[model samples]
Target: ASHGTVHPDNEDWTCFEQSASLDIKSFFGFESTVEKIAMKQYTSNIKKGKEIIEYYLKQLEEEGITFVPRWTPPVACKSESSTSHTRRPVSPAINIPDSATKEGLNNKEILNTSSSPSEPTAGTPDDKLDADYIKRYLGDLTPMQESCLIRLRQWLQETHKGKIPKDEHILRFLRARDFNIDKAREILCQSLTWRKQHQVDYILDTWNPPQVLQDYYAGGWHHHDKDGRPLYVLRLGQMDTKGLVRALGEEALLRYVLSINEEGLRRCEENTKVFGRPISSWTCLVDLEGLNMRHLWRPGVKALLRIIEVVEANYPETLGRLLILRAPRVFPVLWTLVSPFIDDNTRKKFLIYAGNDYQGPGGLLDYIDKEIIPDFLGGECMCEVPEGGLVPKSLYRTAEELENEDIKLWTETIYQSASVFKGAPHEVLIQIVDASSVITWDFDVCKGDIVFNIFHSKRAPQPPKKDSLGAHSITSPGGNNVQLIDKVWQLGRDYSMVESPLICKEGESVQGSHVTRWPGFYILQWKFHSMPACATTNLPRVDDVLASLQVSSHKCKVMYYTEVIGSEDFRGSMTSLESSHSGFSQLSAATTSSSQSHSSSMISR
Candidate 1:
């Protein structure tokens, strides 16, 4: 609406702009032009007015305010008691959703909720703006912020068909993105998709940690913090990060970490009810007493960074605070590698204490209850967290085994089963980009005897152009085998044997690795092992007769898995380079430590 009014004495309908100084006496000189401008302005103002009104309505809904019809009649009902007591009308809990009614109950009710960890809750408690927690960490939202939350929830509901996350969860994402609806919705939708794909909703009931993790993982949930937030203690310094990565591989470790986060979210909801306040995030205390260079193993660090990236993307604003105690001199290097991936708001929550700094004033006691502090940190309470030690090399799995195990978590086995005929061999081509890269294989001989060989070629082999159905066919024999090497190629000229052929018997399992001497294409071949014509004699012994029968079958079956790892991340993961023709010796613990030390030096530089 225009601010200036038409002069009473002006018959030409002259108008002056109130804020503009250079306006003519008759700004609206023509009636048609004035009407056109007025109509355009009216349309824009109407749209703006509608948006403002919608925003106000959303704010009212958020505050639990609803306008009932004035013509509605009062209900006639019998009171619980016959006494003349006033029956005051009670307003629905302000800012509380229907799903949040079950939370923030007494301690006994919290215990009951804990009995079913996987059971879906109505909703988490809404941390009202009046709470001090809201004013301190999660600032009180303005009307615009509330509007963003409302828009985000509606967007999710339209896209997601499953149970919608509570408003609090949606609000956390909003705050994480600084109330930017587009950014917050992007990450939130991605997280929801990830949760659905991984079946993370039922992780508590479905996932069972392996025994190694149960005995060796150095982190666990402790008591609540001073602000009623759940507390988690991690003894990172004492943990063998290399051992865990090697033992479990990156995917398994990632899944374990994800489960921990899911469990933490559950605990947060429970604490919210028990504390009678909104506890949306958890507090973590990390003890870095035994930190050293060994923890900087390349593969381990890579795994940690991947886990951090995932957590930061999906679980934003879930870490209320992070306390670092007994920070070692080497901590700076690790921090340099990790801190860049953390969110700025999350980084602000971190409090660092070097050496015995935590023991003095303004330390652990300020945030955690004195009696609840873990005994390992000089407090009387004994923490149930494991004192993780080095995992025995005997428990470590081969690279191929680890890869298969990791794949199984997200899908089916990576291993493929193939039939090896007497003439047609099953071959797989692997391209190595760097020399000293480790190529590892694990295969089981499911039928007759077979021979495994590794060959390196400067030029890639062209696979057979067509599939033929026979034992002597150039392509797949039993719909599985594939022969890659050409018959016209000479071994000495076209390719070289990188490892000696190893003959494996029926029902035997073989696992081996070879360090490549040159970067090129490597083919792993499983060939049928035929016995000599004269080896079996007539009227032979029982074992000889059985072997003759097996050889006569002319077909062998093998299930195998293979993986190539960069030399930098190899980390001496394999115990032996059992078939190396390049004079490469067995990979040992000392070699692993040396590689990690070199990598750590590079990081520091």
Candidate 2:
């Protein structure tokens, strides 16, 4: 409500257009309680709220005595009438909703405003994100996770030309890569490219499994878990995997799996709305009652491994839990063959049960509501999933025909592999044009252990030219050339280490980033991973303790890439990277030297 217009000569108070704003974020759906409390607090102190205003009012006039107007009901808002200070009811008592009542209400009115100071910006292309909405719509994430999503999403929106994923989809990749935005970006970008190339986004519409998958595929969604996650039931024991591959071929089977995952994401979204919480992942119940050697036939196992790789890379963090019930005696053989392919994070979700042990404590009942459990599992619910059967010999495809699907699996191979020898390190020279620009890397150790390090030198480093070789990749420096940077130039005096030496083990896909301070030559060096036999002070001094001293017993293989993001693109993202410096903290901090960010995955990123 506005105060009356001021008369310059008679009045000491100035005119105001609007009253002081009152902000209430949320009430956890108990809005009435908030209104009731607000009403009592404001109206009870009708005169009390005016203590300061009353003091000022006395200064304007000769009389020190003051009077405050009576409080008006919430419904009696000021009418939009000119030349009148009268109040009018917004609506009748009977017509008024429970959200507005006569028992002292402080109803909230949403303002028509362009933007709010309190609302945080989002990770979308154009719209600003609200932090509260992210916390509610996504999982409860740390500030680092939130910041990483914002920065990475912004980068993708700017860089990625095709359809960018939704914020929640991007969040999965972030979670998969441990919320390292730079790493997630590298992985997500590659996945997005693969999706566009292979049309994974349109799989739901364009792809359909052969009739064999529909009748013989032993998986379908059951009711929700106790925690409200959408649950999928897969009878692996009953599933004729070899038969399906023989009938539909691996391509058809793989496409069917993709379609299921796409459907799962859709169901998860629907469940999120149904349950009124973020549900980005789904629980799975895998029953292996008759899992035998026949199910693990070599050809079937190969197809299974291919399917696993595709899913793990493209659909990370999607399995909320996997309840493996009624595992057969041969289950260990299957697990041994497939466990390495599954990510450590994903593998942790597997709860294996041999025999009829699922009924015991820490089993299916712990995750699934007893009432919703299927009748076959000793619960009352009747499950409608197909009872899988083997495909006949006439349906089997030729061995030559199965060869066609093997070639399309190239979508997952985004990185080019290189061998890093012990003494002959794999070196890449990065020429920084601007200071404070972010340097990022994403790579996987495919064969052996390797130590990664970055160094900056004033002089340009000697490396192969950029067309035949990659722009930054070091495919063996010129044989007769001097060291990448002058060896005489002291470590601290001539060049400083940008990132600490990172030791990467086989099967670990590492991603890291650092903001450059100086515009000069930066050499990213990866040497065969090694450890000294004993303490080094007694022996010849080595600059880096983790640096490899002797020639490696074997060559290490790595697939890697590097890029530079403008300072402006990653301006506010450094904070998240700083807190993520899990091990790259051997160097002293500088104004422009960003803390190293480290993240890894089991699969080739």
The candidate that achieves the highest lDDT relative to the unseen native structure: 1
Give candidate 1 misplaced runs (Cα > 4 Å).
1-139, 403-605
**lDDT values for all models:** 0.65, 0.61
* Cα shift from native, residue 513, model 2 (Å): 48
**Model 2 per-residue lDDT tens digits across residues 310-391:** 9998898899988877765344435555767888788767676656767776767888888899877788999988889676
Name model 2 segments beyond 4 Å from true. 1-129, 399-605
Provide the TM-score for each candidate, comma-separated: 0.50, 0.48
Candidate 2: clashing pairs of residues: 121-129, 122-129
C-alpha-based local distance difference test score of model 2: 0.61
Cα error of candidate 1 at position 17, Å? 31
Whose TM-score is greatest here? 1
RMSD in Å for model 1: 16.5
